[model samples]
Target: MSIAEKLSQMGVTLPDAPAPAANYVPSVRSGDLLFVSGQVSSGADGLIKGRLGADMSVEDGAAAARACAISLLAQVRAACDGDIDRLDRVVKLTGFVNCTPEFGDMPAVVNGASDFLVEVLGEAGRHSRSAVGANLPFGVAVEIEGIFRLR
Candidate 1:
């Protein structure tokens, strides 16, 4: 099945690709690769804001990370000129989690994005990743940037 069909089966409808929050564009293409800017955690309800190891639990942070992944896909779609299937595979993801200084579960929190992508895109979704704890902008729980190889 196509990526659209897969997303539908998973009960997700990609939101409109978000505009850049600063001078930088949301995505840039070089050669066959698309590099997407960081997508902050957000959903229909609005930004998922909190600091893990402080007010947010691991599960909640994971959910926020998943929202970032959705936004990443939306950006990817826009980069492909609305044809997400042109994406060959996810190349890498760098995830940032807002958390207390001692927080040690960053990898598990970022797993939210990793697992969701794998579920939707299967093997193509698998990619190298880095998850780290940081004080993110706007107090959002997560932010993720991605690199995709286009078909």
Candidate 2:
């Protein structure tokens, strides 16, 4: 029924919000919009890591991308005072995939995050998205950022 319950139904667990790696805050809000910093799949116990379509398979990249999405949501929850249910709409998402020069499955990899959000929030998760291939992404295979319009 609620977003948190939906996550539980899907067996998705949100980790503690990771601290920013640089000068940026994890999430910032101005007016009714909340912008989350780019989140890379990192610093968990033992996540598989490497360049997508190079050292990793498509499935791995997808998984990493999904992880990044959850990190973004964790930041959102923290920013909105530990309640993801308060978000009314996920407005936009931009994802970056670190891949080999010839890799072209970037969209599929990013779908991991897009799909995860939809599963967690149902209709509220729908959003515009961009999935781009990059030379590198903070040394990880996937990075995702999100913008949410909250109630």
Candidate 3:
């Protein structure tokens, strides 16, 4: 089935692609690769704001990362002219988690996005990834960026 159909089977409804919060394009294509800008943890309820290991739990941070992933996919869909199936493979993901200096579970937190992508796209979703703790913009719990190979 197509990627869009897969998303539907997973009960995911992509939100409208969000406008860039700064003077940057949401996604850019170069040759056969597409790079997506960092996407914060945002949804209909608004940004998921908190610092892990301080006020939030690892599970909550993971959820925030998952939300960021969803936003990233929305940008990717837009870059493909509203068709996510144009994506051939996920190349890499860089995830940043807002957390206290002592927080050391960044990898687990980012697994939320990684696992979701694998569930949705199967083998094409497996990719190199980095999960790091950092002070994120707007005090959001998580931010994620992606690189994809286009069909």
> For this target, which candidate reaches the highest lDDT against the unseen true structure?
1
Question: What TM-score should be assigned to candidate 2?
Answer: 0.93
For candidate 3, write residues 1-151 as lDDT tens digits: 8989999988999999889999999998999999999999987899999999999999998899889889989999999889889989999999999999999999999998999889888999999999999999899999999999999
lDDT of each: 0.95, 0.85, 0.93
Error of 2 at 74 (Å): 0.4
Q: Work out the TM-score per prediction.
A: 0.98, 0.93, 0.98
Candidate 2 residue runs with Cα over 4 Å from true position: 46-48
Q: What lDDT score is found at residue 129 in candidate 2?
A: 96
Worst 10 residues of 2 by lDDT: 41-50
Name the lDDT of candidate 3: 0.93
Q: Which runs of model 1 end up more than 4 angstroms from their true locations?
A: none
Stretches > 4 Å off in candidate 3: none
- What's the true lDDT of residue 128 in model 1? 100
lDDT of 2 by residue, 76-123 (tens): 888879898888889999999998889999999998899888888878
Clashes in model 1: which pairs? none
Candidate 1 residue lDDT tens string, 53-122: 9999999999999999999999999988899889889999999999999899999999999999999999
RMSD per model, one decimal: 0.6, 1.5, 0.7
> What's the distance in Å from true for residue 141, model 1?
0.3
